[model samples]
Target: MSEPGTPRTQRLRHEAETAAARFPALLAEAQIIAASVVHGTHGRRRPGSGETFWEYRHYRREDAASAIDWRRSARGDQLFVRETEWEAANAVHLWRDGGAGMALASPGRPLKRDRAAVCLMALASLLSRGGERIAALGETGRARAGRTGLERTLHALAEGPGSTRAIEAPELPRHARVVLASDFLDPPETTAARLSALTAAGAEGALLRIVDPAEEDFPFTGRTRFRDPGLGANLLFGRAETARDAYRGLWREHGAALGDVARKAGFTLITHRTDRPAASAVLSLYQAIAGLR
Candidate 1:
């Protein structure tokens, strides 16, 4: 193991401090987005049901000693209170593409990855407010509910997007919900197969397609040079505008395929441009998720 003040240790410490500093601000934004989606209702879509979903919150002094979740509390310095969901909420698995492509953005625009994170975080907070359980797709163990679930999702997001190319198709419970945000620039067949597997498992969800303005409007002209962000390859176009039609044609084909897949799987398709308001995407995504049976 490295010593306490070693460079590696210091880097890790700095990373932790950065995440710590970001948590509050991130959560606040998420909550604000969540609230904006369904003002004064905590994003609740329906009446409460009797089902129980184990979730966590900070322990309060007024709570009984027996209410403390000793095992979870042991994981950190703070006490925790385990709670049961009193709403008609269910599980919602979440995933976001974390590839270098997602890091792409036009000038003065937020990265696709960043926009995806905001949408995911806002959706998680909205669901948590209504008592829905959430877990990273393909993660081990049960889905977490309430505030802790949102916390866990935030941490997962801060860890960076996992594999950018191939998405996992882990088994989900029947009627379970999923919410995935990505550029979905992969081969249409790959996305189709993943969705097929999940649909076959009796799961339903929404696909929030995050896009960049530059991508949507291939506005390059004379003597333009294009670089592949992932492969680091470069292509020089004498007149990039001449190729715009072909590029857009391919883009349309890809989008059409995705729409077909979502339609076949009975999932909702949501498209958001990074240049647009994140609130609109957040609201649409939450509504789509909430409507999932």
Candidate 2:
């Protein structure tokens, strides 16, 4: 390991501190987005029943006598029955790409990495609130639940795997859910192979594409300097606008391939732009995981 005060160590320390400082705001924004979605709906629609109190209603003829809330019933002439919401608190593994490619964005847009982070945190907030467990992929062997789990997940994500690297499929419980946020610019076959492994392990989840608007539009004209942020490779274009049609075509093909892979793996894939509202993506994630739509 490098010395404690060395440049590498100092950089690591600085990143940790920065993550710590940003945690509150990041989590707060997550909570806000989660809350909005929660209020707009009844709750998550997952398998299995839960003990958490959902609501209280007047006892009906079809209701079992044992289901009656006796304590509350005694206060009124009418009998009441306690109802519980369906909380299939399954383990949800989250992973966000932090690669250099994800760091790219348009002049007025947030970095793809930042947007991915927000979506991850917001989803965590929703899952935590719904009494589900969460784990960052490749971080822990087992998933965690509640507030502590959320904190642990955030920390792991901040210091976890490199973005440019291939995804390291974690050993997860059977039937566990996963949520992955990335631009997914990787080779389709590579991504497919990894996802296929997870599916074979009985894991199911959603894939989110965090993209920049400029990536789709290709608004650059005249001469342009195109560089690979991760590889540090540079390419100069005399007429970048001339390549727009081909680039957009390739982008579509990439998306189609990803969709096919997701379909085979029994997962859902949704794309969101940095310029769009984060809540939209969060809602889509919630629905996909909940198997709603």
Candidate 3:
């Protein structure tokens, strides 16, 4: 490691500062939302023998022989590894879209990107309180629990995923869970495939699609201009109302297709508009991942 005052040290310091500075207000808002959301108790159902005193998980190859509960294993063909409640749901990866299009907002609304970030951070805050291990997609850092886990995840998220629509889903171990937040305005097939990749290891997964109310409602009439921030393309409409019926039809079809894809891939998809309450989306998403909903 480089010593303090060196160029490398300066760069590292700058990075940390930048990450810490990127989302102070956003992080605070997220925590507030998280704190207010109504959380329910998780049921004792999957991933282990329904029992008391200790939780049991299926033994993975990475587990040490010492960690295996041989008595439990002898009761069944499958090997069982025992753990506390703290260790049961830590294999979670969280992602948010950093594309330019996510920056769009209506005149009186918050940005889609901002809402998505808030929802993602709020979920992280909520999960961290449960001692769940949280990691960011593509992060090399080990997943951690509690406050430090939230900080680590936020730092990774601040680095942004770039402007590409294509996602890079890192390899993860079995039983991991992933929650991804984005506008998901891409073609339904593309979005579905990318999301499915997050759970390729038999992990559970969820999608939170952020939307602008204007996009959903098509409230524009008369002359209107639309811009694609990502592609730098613009469209001017003389009578935007004329396209309302077609736009609504296409929008519904797209949503349906996305829902179907998520169903087939065994993933849960939650759509939230910037005009809606972040707490509701966060609550639903948290429940979905925690198996409480």
How many residue pairs clash in all the candidates, one count each? 0, 0, 1
Clash pairs for candidate 1:
none
Model 2 ranges with Cα > 4 A deviation: 1-13, 44-89, 162-167
In candidate 3, which residue ranges exceed 4 Å CA deviation?
A: 1-22, 38-89, 162-167
Among these predicted structures, which one has the highest TM-score? 2
lDDT to native, each model: 0.76, 0.78, 0.75
**TM-score of each model, in listed order:** 0.76, 0.78, 0.75
lDDT tens digits, residue span 67-116, model 1 = 78899999989998766654213778788787888889899987787778
Q: Write model 2 residue lDDT over 231-275, tens digit each, in one string.
A: 899999999999999999999999999999989888899999999
lDDT of 3 by residue, 203-255 (tens): 67788989999999999999998988978899999999999999999999999
Q: List the residue pairs that clash in candidate 2.
A: none
Model 3 per-residue lDDT at 43? 25
